[model samples]
Target: MWSDHAPLTIQLTSPLHKPKTMTWRLHENLLSNPQVAQDIQQALTNYFAENLPQDTSPLLTWEAHKCVIRGILISHSSALKKAQEHTIRELTAKIGTLTQAHKRTLDDTLLRELTAAREELARVLRQS
Candidate 1:
């Protein structure tokens, strides 16, 4: 039976959703490229080896070496990415200036050099 006024009811069985996982995927070539991957791995290993204690207990030395190596790897990776960004920015600025030149523009040699720099940047970005 319905009454003149009735209270409302609400129910929720589940909470709002969010992404299950977040990922930053690098290029397949970055991982699949043996040379680059090997180089990175070898560098990390060398870093650990160099920092490891020569005549000390394994446990403490291993832990310390691992921490240092991890820090170095993270810093190195960030540095590489930053360097790439800087190179690209520099290339872009050079190209923009050349393209926006006045009637009395750059000479042939300067124009060619600018073009070459841009092309080199493109090549590096593609490889990365």
Candidate 2:
């Protein structure tokens, strides 16, 4: 085993690497769940399309969140309900304007939107 001709295996490590995880086995008898899948795919595509940086690598990647929105979108969260009834449609329409906005302006506007959305979500979460 120590001979020069022997093959070697090496493990790679990264200081920032997190452990792998397992999630819900959603496919279990959910073969007919195409609507749920379509909703998630549409939301994910919208998120990526809207948020991807123009020319450089993005600071955040969708994979980093591991599709957390799937649970959020499906849950009976008051935040989701309230947002749909309140600002969501307006925000969605505003997305098209980002193309003409300056980067700094976009950043500030988006951060404000994110904070508002988060507060609403947190309020609903606390209630439940």
Candidate 3:
């Protein structure tokens, strides 16, 4: 009974539960890319050509088609994101180098190049 520390107790009033459902969505920007559009179009055509003659239910075929298209979109979107991130990193480095050069020379040409690079970086960032 000589302990100086106080005892602590914790209690939960209700049981915690995790959400049971997840929603999947396509990135609309991916659709705007011509290569992605062509790939999806080709996938849909192939899917129907191979499966349309089957006796499977229409609902099942539709669901399966959705899964196929989702895979394509996800892959293409991830690749595009990677490329954009690479471009962003390159632009950032170029800007940093140009800033250092401009600081030393104060040349108009370097200033213009730096400005252009900054604008390009901003455009890429906005797309991402």
Candidate 4:
């Protein structure tokens, strides 16, 4: 006699373990911003001035300086990204509103405005 239930097979395997490493690269576009350049210069100047003590090793100071520069770049990059996102959102909303108005009246002025807004939005999206 055979049972109605089918046989089941289960396979078990160990999970793979790998070390996680983080790599950060600077966005070259940020260099074009005058504010970022100024902020980096100020941070380097302060780091050097404060670490001028004779007891500090040059190698350690150099390493620490790298960290300081990284921090500045990261902060500026984050801020820039946030601002770009905000602009993109606003442009999207403006485009939506203008498109609706243009559709309702089919006015030449509204059409022109909507076209301009769409172009602006495209530009902002490309930058981000």
Top TM-score prediction, candidate number: 4
Best by lDDT: 3
Per-residue lDDT over 82-128 for candidate 2, one digit per residue giving the tens place of the 0 to 100 score: 76555545544454354335354667766666566556655655543
Q: Estimate, for each residue in 15-68, the C-alpha lDDT of model 3 and write its tens digit.
A: 565657967778888888899999999999999988884678889999999999
Off by more than 4 A, model 4: 1-21
- Candidate 1 segments whose C-alpha is farther than 4 A from its true place: 1-64, 102-107
Cα distance off (Å), candidate 1, residue 97: 0.5
Writing each residue's lDDT as its tens digit, candidate 4 over 11-128 gives: 8665885657989998998889899999999998999999985869999999999999999999998988899899888988998998898889999999898899889988888877
Ranking by lDDT: 3, 4, 1, 2
Off by over 4 Å in 3: 1-23, 53-55
What's model 2's overall lDDT? 0.56
Clashing pairs in 4: none
The estimated TM-scores of all candidates read: 0.48, 0.29, 0.76, 0.80
Ten-residue region with minimum lDDT total, candidate 4: 11-20
For 1-128, candidate 1 gives per-residue lDDT tens digits of 76887688998556665647955444444455566667668866886676566766778777776665455455556667798898888888877777666225757876787778778878978956
Instruction: Return the TM-score for candidate 3, rounded to 2 decimals.
Output: 0.76
